[model samples]
Target: MSIAISTALQSSFADAVTRTREALAGQGFGVLTEIDMKATLKAKLDQDMENYLILGACNPPLAHRAVDIDRQIGLLLPCNVVVRTDPDDDTRVLVEAMNPQLLVQVTGDPALQEVADEVTAKLRAAIQALGPTSG
Candidate 1:
């Protein structure tokens, strides 16, 4: 399975980030944390990079269900969604979300299958809501 559910949009990086947040919220996810990778790296390592933001999104009900099935699941809690400018094309931006199904694969737990499938569906819907994917 693909590691991330993603889409490439022909949009400004700022616009892409706004739309991504709206999409995730529409799917019942809230951003618990936001990390501006570009800023952080520049300040810490004096390294420059394309505009990049990492959103730690969570759907509480689904997260609770998964955690109930396995306590250690918190390690993977709060799905990561990345909105960044495409390195090769300044006008193109990429939005990507972690594939929840990986949790079932990594944990090798059949019990998580239902929750994983549900989360995967919600995540896919959110990504699709952004707009037509160029790639």
Candidate 2:
């Protein structure tokens, strides 16, 4: 199975977050929501956890174009990216997204597939510019 692009980096938790948001925006994506996992877990379970943030990002034009081709593509809308702390207390972040090719299989729409492929590469470039290589 092909896992999503994940990576570790040496940066402050806040810096990682800011950089991620900036990079995503720079690449034409806008952050739709920010989920603070650590705060949520602590508030609900009274458990202390490392810093973790979830970012819901979307590119309006591309997304609209994709949905035009395959209305069901909404299932894959708003790509998710995460920022979390490592064991050593350093910050790391990862972006988990469905493979665009898989979306092609589901939608069976060539144009929609093209959009997914381009978005995937754009997201990859955004993450790589911010941290360690993801293999």
Candidate 3:
């Protein structure tokens, strides 16, 4: 299975990032952490890259359910969503979200399948909300 669900939007990098966060919130997810990859790479490695962001998103109830199913599931508690400029075309932005089903594979627990399916559905909805170009 694909590790992530992705889409391309014809929007400014900054606008795509903002819209993505809003979309996640509409689906009952909250941003728990934000990683500015461009800034990090420049500061730590002196490498310049496109505007890229990583939003650590979590739906509390789902997270709690998964954790209750398997304590070690915390390792994948928050789903990561990334927004970045298309290297070949700066006018377009790419957004990709983690696939929760991977949790079932990692934990070998059938119980997690439901939670994964639910989370995946929500994440997919959030991405689709971006518009016709979204996947």
| Number of the candidate with higher TM-score, 2 or 3 | 3
Candidate with maximal TM-score: 1
What's the lDDT for candidate 1? 0.93
lDDT of 2 by residue, 46-128 (tens): 98878878888898988888888878888877778877888464444444444456667666777776787888787878878
lDDT of 1 by residue, 25-107 (tens): 99999999999999999999999999999999999999999999999999998899999999999999999999999999999
Off by over 4 Å in 3: 133-135
- Across 3-122, the per-residue lDDT of candidate 3 in tens digits comes to 888899999988899899999999999999999999999999999999999999999999999999999999886899999998899888999999898999978999999999999999
On lDDT, the leading prediction is: 1
Candidate 3: residue pairs that collide: none
Sort every candidate by TM-score, greatest first.
Answer: 1, 3, 2
Candidate 2 scores a C-alpha RMSD against the true structure in Å of 2.4
Q: Assess the local accuracy of residue 88 in candidate 1 as a C-alpha lDDT between 0 and 100.
A: 94
Candidate 1, TM-score vs. the true structure?
0.97
